[model samples]
Target: MPNDHHNAPQTGLSYYGLSLLSYLRESHPDLADDADFIRTRAQAAAEAYSCIIRSGGSRIEAAEEADTVLYRGLHFSLYGTLANVIRSEFADIIPEEDAREAALILLPQAREVARSYELADDFAATPQYALLYTELTGTVQILLDNGIQ
Candidate 1:
Protein backbone atom coordinates (compact mmCIF):
# COMPACT_ATOMS: atom_id res chain seq x y z
CA MET A 1 0.00 0.00 0.00
CA PRO A 2 1.03 3.59 -0.57
CA ASN A 3 2.21 5.70 2.32
CA ASP A 4 -1.00 7.41 3.38
CA HIS A 5 0.65 8.83 6.45
CA HIS A 6 3.07 10.72 4.24
CA ASN A 7 0.20 12.25 2.30
CA ALA A 8 -1.63 13.32 5.41
CA PRO A 9 -0.87 16.71 6.85
CA GLN A 10 2.13 16.90 9.14
CA THR A 11 1.33 15.49 12.56
CA GLY A 12 4.40 14.94 14.65
CA LEU A 13 6.74 16.34 17.25
CA SER A 14 7.83 19.41 15.30
CA TYR A 15 4.30 20.59 14.65
CA TYR A 16 3.45 19.73 18.24
CA GLY A 17 6.32 21.96 19.36
CA LEU A 18 5.02 24.84 17.27
CA SER A 19 1.54 24.35 18.67
CA LEU A 20 3.02 24.33 22.17
CA LEU A 21 5.02 27.49 21.45
CA SER A 22 1.87 29.20 20.15
CA TYR A 23 -0.02 28.28 23.28
CA LEU A 24 2.85 29.46 25.46
CA ARG A 25 3.05 32.73 23.53
CA GLU A 26 -0.53 33.40 24.37
CA SER A 27 -0.53 32.12 27.93
CA HIS A 28 3.12 32.52 28.97
CA PRO A 29 5.19 34.83 26.84
CA ASP A 30 8.33 34.35 28.88
CA LEU A 31 8.52 30.69 28.00
CA ALA A 32 7.57 31.37 24.41
CA ASP A 33 10.77 33.29 23.93
CA ASP A 34 12.68 29.99 24.26
CA ALA A 35 11.80 28.94 20.74
CA ASP A 36 15.27 27.71 19.89
CA PHE A 37 15.29 25.45 22.91
CA ILE A 38 11.84 24.08 22.11
CA ARG A 39 12.60 23.52 18.43
CA THR A 40 15.81 21.67 19.12
CA ARG A 41 14.15 19.28 21.51
CA ALA A 42 11.19 18.73 19.23
CA GLN A 43 13.43 18.08 16.24
CA ALA A 44 15.43 15.46 18.10
CA ALA A 45 12.27 13.77 19.34
CA ALA A 46 10.73 13.83 15.86
CA GLU A 47 13.77 12.19 14.36
CA ALA A 48 13.62 9.41 16.95
CA TYR A 49 9.90 8.93 16.34
CA SER A 50 10.41 8.75 12.58
CA CYS A 51 13.14 6.22 13.00
CA ILE A 52 10.84 3.92 14.95
CA ILE A 53 8.11 4.25 12.35
CA ARG A 54 10.57 3.55 9.58
CA SER A 55 11.86 0.53 11.43
CA GLY A 56 8.36 -0.93 11.29
CA GLY A 57 7.64 -0.53 14.94
CA SER A 58 3.95 -0.49 15.80
CA ARG A 59 2.42 2.94 16.05
CA ILE A 60 1.91 2.40 19.76
CA GLU A 61 5.57 1.52 20.23
CA ALA A 62 6.70 4.47 18.21
CA ALA A 63 4.46 6.79 20.15
CA GLU A 64 5.75 5.41 23.44
CA GLU A 65 9.28 5.98 22.35
CA ALA A 66 8.40 9.46 21.26
CA ASP A 67 6.78 10.14 24.59
CA THR A 68 10.04 9.28 26.34
CA VAL A 69 11.87 11.75 24.15
CA LEU A 70 9.21 14.37 24.69
CA TYR A 71 9.23 13.93 28.44
CA ARG A 72 12.97 14.35 28.63
CA GLY A 73 13.07 17.22 26.16
CA LEU A 74 9.79 19.08 25.75
CA HIS A 75 8.46 18.40 29.21
CA PHE A 76 11.67 19.48 30.87
CA SER A 77 11.93 22.61 28.77
CA LEU A 78 8.36 23.70 29.49
CA TYR A 79 7.49 22.44 32.94
CA GLY A 80 10.87 22.00 34.61
CA THR A 81 12.12 25.36 33.45
CA LEU A 82 8.86 27.00 34.44
CA ALA A 83 9.13 25.52 37.90
CA ASN A 84 12.68 26.73 38.28
CA VAL A 85 11.84 30.22 37.08
CA ILE A 86 8.83 30.49 39.33
CA ARG A 87 10.71 29.28 42.36
CA SER A 88 13.70 31.49 41.79
CA GLU A 89 12.01 34.69 40.64
CA PHE A 90 8.40 34.62 41.81
CA ALA A 91 8.59 32.56 44.96
CA ASP A 92 7.53 35.64 46.87
CA ILE A 93 4.39 35.94 44.79
CA ILE A 94 3.33 32.28 44.94
CA PRO A 95 3.11 30.13 47.99
CA GLU A 96 4.76 26.73 48.01
CA GLU A 97 1.44 24.91 48.40
CA ASP A 98 -0.18 26.80 45.53
CA ALA A 99 2.79 26.19 43.28
CA ARG A 100 2.65 22.51 44.05
CA GLU A 101 -1.06 22.42 43.34
CA ALA A 102 -0.64 24.25 40.08
CA ALA A 103 1.99 21.79 38.98
CA LEU A 104 -0.25 18.85 39.81
CA ILE A 105 -3.08 20.35 37.82
CA LEU A 106 -1.23 21.75 34.82
CA LEU A 107 1.28 19.01 34.15
CA PRO A 108 -1.17 16.39 32.99
CA GLN A 109 -3.38 18.91 31.25
CA ALA A 110 -0.42 20.31 29.40
CA ARG A 111 0.65 16.82 28.40
CA GLU A 112 -2.81 16.17 27.04
CA VAL A 113 -2.64 19.39 25.07
CA ALA A 114 0.69 18.36 23.61
CA ARG A 115 -0.60 14.88 22.79
CA SER A 116 -3.54 16.40 20.94
CA TYR A 117 -1.20 18.30 18.71
CA GLU A 118 1.01 15.26 18.21
CA LEU A 119 -1.87 13.11 17.03
CA ALA A 120 -4.11 15.54 15.20
CA ASP A 121 -3.15 17.00 11.87
CA ASP A 122 -4.97 20.30 12.36
CA PHE A 123 -5.65 20.42 16.06
CA ALA A 124 -5.22 24.19 16.17
CA ALA A 125 -8.15 24.61 13.80
CA THR A 126 -10.51 22.58 15.94
CA PRO A 127 -13.03 24.07 18.34
CA GLN A 128 -11.87 21.70 21.05
CA TYR A 129 -8.36 23.07 20.62
CA ALA A 130 -9.66 26.54 21.41
CA LEU A 131 -11.41 25.18 24.44
CA LEU A 132 -8.21 23.50 25.60
CA TYR A 133 -6.30 26.72 25.18
CA THR A 134 -8.90 28.65 27.15
CA GLU A 135 -8.95 26.08 29.88
CA LEU A 136 -5.17 25.94 30.18
CA THR A 137 -4.83 29.71 30.25
CA GLY A 138 -7.68 30.05 32.69
CA THR A 139 -6.02 27.61 35.02
CA VAL A 140 -2.77 29.54 34.86
CA GLN A 141 -4.56 32.84 35.41
CA ILE A 142 -6.45 31.49 38.35
CA LEU A 143 -3.25 30.21 39.89
CA LEU A 144 -1.59 33.57 39.40
CA ASP A 145 -4.52 35.38 40.92
CA ASN A 146 -4.57 33.09 43.91
CA GLY A 147 -0.89 33.70 44.42
CA ILE A 148 -1.24 37.48 44.36
CA GLN A 149 -3.08 37.77 47.64
Candidate 2:
Protein backbone atom coordinates (compact mmCIF):
# COMPACT_ATOMS: atom_id res chain seq x y z
CA MET A 1 0.00 0.00 0.00
CA PRO A 2 1.30 3.45 -0.99
CA ASN A 3 4.77 1.86 -0.84
CA ASP A 4 5.10 3.18 2.71
CA HIS A 5 8.57 1.63 2.50
CA HIS A 6 7.26 -0.20 5.54
CA ASN A 7 3.89 -1.77 4.86
CA ALA A 8 4.10 -4.13 1.87
CA PRO A 9 1.63 -7.02 1.74
CA GLN A 10 3.47 -9.67 3.68
CA THR A 11 0.93 -12.47 3.63
CA GLY A 12 -2.31 -11.11 2.23
CA LEU A 13 -2.51 -7.43 1.42
CA SER A 14 -0.23 -6.88 -1.59
CA TYR A 15 -1.20 -4.68 -4.52
CA TYR A 16 -0.32 -7.34 -7.08
CA GLY A 17 -2.92 -6.52 -9.72
CA LEU A 18 -2.22 -2.81 -9.69
CA SER A 19 1.47 -3.33 -10.39
CA LEU A 20 0.91 -5.61 -13.40
CA LEU A 21 -2.13 -3.74 -14.68
CA SER A 22 0.01 -0.72 -15.47
CA TYR A 23 2.37 -2.59 -17.78
CA LEU A 24 -0.51 -4.14 -19.69
CA ARG A 25 -2.29 -0.91 -20.55
CA GLU A 26 -1.48 -1.38 -24.23
CA SER A 27 -2.67 -4.13 -26.54
CA HIS A 28 -0.61 -6.48 -28.72
CA PRO A 29 -2.54 -9.44 -30.02
CA ASP A 30 0.48 -10.99 -31.70
CA LEU A 31 2.58 -11.45 -28.61
CA ALA A 32 0.86 -14.48 -27.21
CA ASP A 33 3.57 -15.47 -24.72
CA ASP A 34 3.86 -12.06 -23.12
CA ALA A 35 0.10 -11.67 -23.03
CA ASP A 36 -0.28 -15.05 -21.37
CA PHE A 37 2.31 -14.23 -18.73
CA ILE A 38 0.62 -10.94 -17.90
CA ARG A 39 -2.79 -12.50 -17.69
CA THR A 40 -1.67 -15.49 -15.63
CA ARG A 41 0.34 -13.59 -13.05
CA ALA A 42 -2.39 -10.99 -12.58
CA GLN A 43 -5.02 -13.63 -12.04
CA ALA A 44 -2.88 -15.69 -9.68
CA ALA A 45 -1.79 -12.74 -7.62
CA ALA A 46 -5.41 -11.65 -7.32
CA GLU A 47 -6.41 -15.08 -6.13
CA ALA A 48 -3.51 -15.40 -3.70
CA TYR A 49 -4.16 -11.99 -2.19
CA SER A 50 -7.84 -12.77 -2.00
CA CYS A 51 -7.17 -16.07 -0.31
CA ILE A 52 -5.01 -14.38 2.26
CA ILE A 53 -7.74 -11.87 2.97
CA ARG A 54 -10.52 -14.43 3.18
CA SER A 55 -8.59 -16.25 5.85
CA GLY A 56 -8.91 -13.20 8.13
CA GLY A 57 -5.90 -11.11 7.21
CA SER A 58 -6.66 -7.51 6.21
CA ARG A 59 -6.66 -6.58 2.55
CA ILE A 60 -5.26 -3.38 1.03
CA GLU A 61 -6.61 -3.45 -2.49
CA ALA A 62 -7.67 0.18 -2.23
CA ALA A 63 -4.20 1.35 -3.24
CA GLU A 64 -4.61 -0.63 -6.43
CA GLU A 65 -6.49 2.29 -8.02
CA ALA A 66 -3.93 4.93 -7.08
CA ASP A 67 -0.15 5.26 -7.55
CA THR A 68 0.70 1.58 -7.86
CA VAL A 69 -0.20 1.57 -11.55
CA LEU A 70 0.97 4.70 -13.33
CA TYR A 71 4.03 5.80 -11.38
CA ARG A 72 5.95 2.50 -11.13
CA GLY A 73 6.50 1.26 -14.71
CA LEU A 74 9.33 3.70 -15.44
CA HIS A 75 11.69 1.26 -13.70
CA PHE A 76 11.43 -2.17 -15.37
CA SER A 77 12.13 -1.59 -19.07
CA LEU A 78 14.56 -4.52 -19.50
CA TYR A 79 14.57 -7.45 -21.93
CA GLY A 80 15.64 -10.50 -19.90
CA THR A 81 13.34 -13.33 -18.98
CA LEU A 82 11.11 -12.84 -15.93
CA ALA A 83 13.15 -15.16 -13.73
CA ASN A 84 16.39 -13.39 -14.57
CA VAL A 85 14.83 -10.01 -13.91
CA ILE A 86 13.77 -11.10 -10.45
CA ARG A 87 16.96 -12.96 -9.75
CA SER A 88 19.15 -10.06 -10.78
CA GLU A 89 17.06 -7.28 -9.28
CA PHE A 90 15.63 -8.90 -6.19
CA ALA A 91 18.60 -10.98 -5.25
CA ASP A 92 18.47 -10.45 -1.50
CA ILE A 93 14.99 -9.23 -0.66
CA ILE A 94 12.98 -12.21 -1.74
CA PRO A 95 12.92 -15.59 -0.06
CA GLU A 96 11.28 -18.69 -1.52
CA GLU A 97 7.66 -17.77 -0.97
CA ASP A 98 8.26 -14.08 -1.44
CA ALA A 99 9.96 -14.90 -4.70
CA ARG A 100 7.00 -16.97 -5.72
CA GLU A 101 4.67 -14.17 -4.72
CA ALA A 102 6.74 -11.60 -6.55
CA ALA A 103 6.73 -13.75 -9.66
CA LEU A 104 3.00 -14.11 -9.37
CA ILE A 105 2.93 -10.35 -8.97
CA LEU A 106 5.42 -9.55 -11.73
CA LEU A 107 5.33 -12.06 -14.60
CA PRO A 108 2.62 -10.39 -16.62
CA GLN A 109 3.60 -6.80 -16.00
CA ALA A 110 7.15 -7.81 -16.88
CA ARG A 111 6.04 -9.04 -20.27
CA GLU A 112 4.33 -5.80 -21.08
CA VAL A 113 7.18 -3.74 -19.70
CA ALA A 114 9.55 -5.72 -21.89
CA ARG A 115 7.36 -5.22 -24.93
CA SER A 116 7.16 -1.46 -24.39
CA TYR A 117 10.75 -1.29 -25.57
CA GLU A 118 12.60 -3.22 -28.25
CA LEU A 119 15.46 -5.62 -27.41
CA ALA A 120 18.86 -6.73 -28.75
CA ASP A 121 21.45 -9.50 -28.07
CA ASP A 122 18.80 -11.10 -25.88
CA PHE A 123 16.32 -9.35 -23.58
CA ALA A 124 19.00 -8.56 -21.02
CA ALA A 125 21.18 -6.17 -23.06
CA THR A 126 18.66 -3.67 -24.40
CA PRO A 127 19.18 -0.33 -22.68
CA GLN A 128 15.54 0.59 -22.14
CA TYR A 129 14.74 -2.95 -21.22
CA ALA A 130 17.69 -3.10 -18.81
CA LEU A 131 16.49 0.07 -17.11
CA LEU A 132 13.10 -1.38 -16.36
CA TYR A 133 14.73 -4.65 -15.35
CA THR A 134 16.79 -2.87 -12.78
CA GLU A 135 13.83 -0.85 -11.63
CA LEU A 136 11.94 -3.94 -10.55
CA THR A 137 15.00 -4.92 -8.55
CA GLY A 138 14.85 -1.65 -6.65
CA THR A 139 11.14 -1.95 -6.08
CA VAL A 140 11.58 -5.46 -4.71
CA GLN A 141 14.29 -4.31 -2.34
CA ILE A 142 12.07 -1.52 -1.13
CA LEU A 143 9.22 -3.90 -0.66
CA LEU A 144 11.34 -6.44 1.18
CA ASP A 145 12.98 -3.90 3.44
CA ASN A 146 9.59 -2.46 4.31
CA GLY A 147 8.33 -5.97 5.16
CA ILE A 148 6.69 -7.62 2.15
CA GLN A 149 7.67 -11.00 3.62
lDDT of each: 0.54, 0.47
Q: List, residue by residue over 28-81, the lDDT tens digit for candidate 1.
A: 434555656567656776777899999999888877776666545233233443
lDDT of 1 at 101: 41
TM-score of 1: 0.37
**Which clashing pairs does model 2 show?**
38-108, 75-132, 76-132, 77-129, 77-132, 78-129, 78-130, 79-123, 80-123
Off by over 4 Å in 2: 1-80, 96-101, 107-125
RMSD of each: 15.6, 16.1
TM-score of each: 0.37, 0.32
Model 1 misplaced regions, further than 4 Å: 1-13, 19-30, 73-149
Candidate 1 accuracy as lDDT? 0.54
lDDT of 2 by residue, 7-59 (tens): 22222323554454444332221122343454555566666556656666655
Clash list (residue pairs), candidate 1 = none
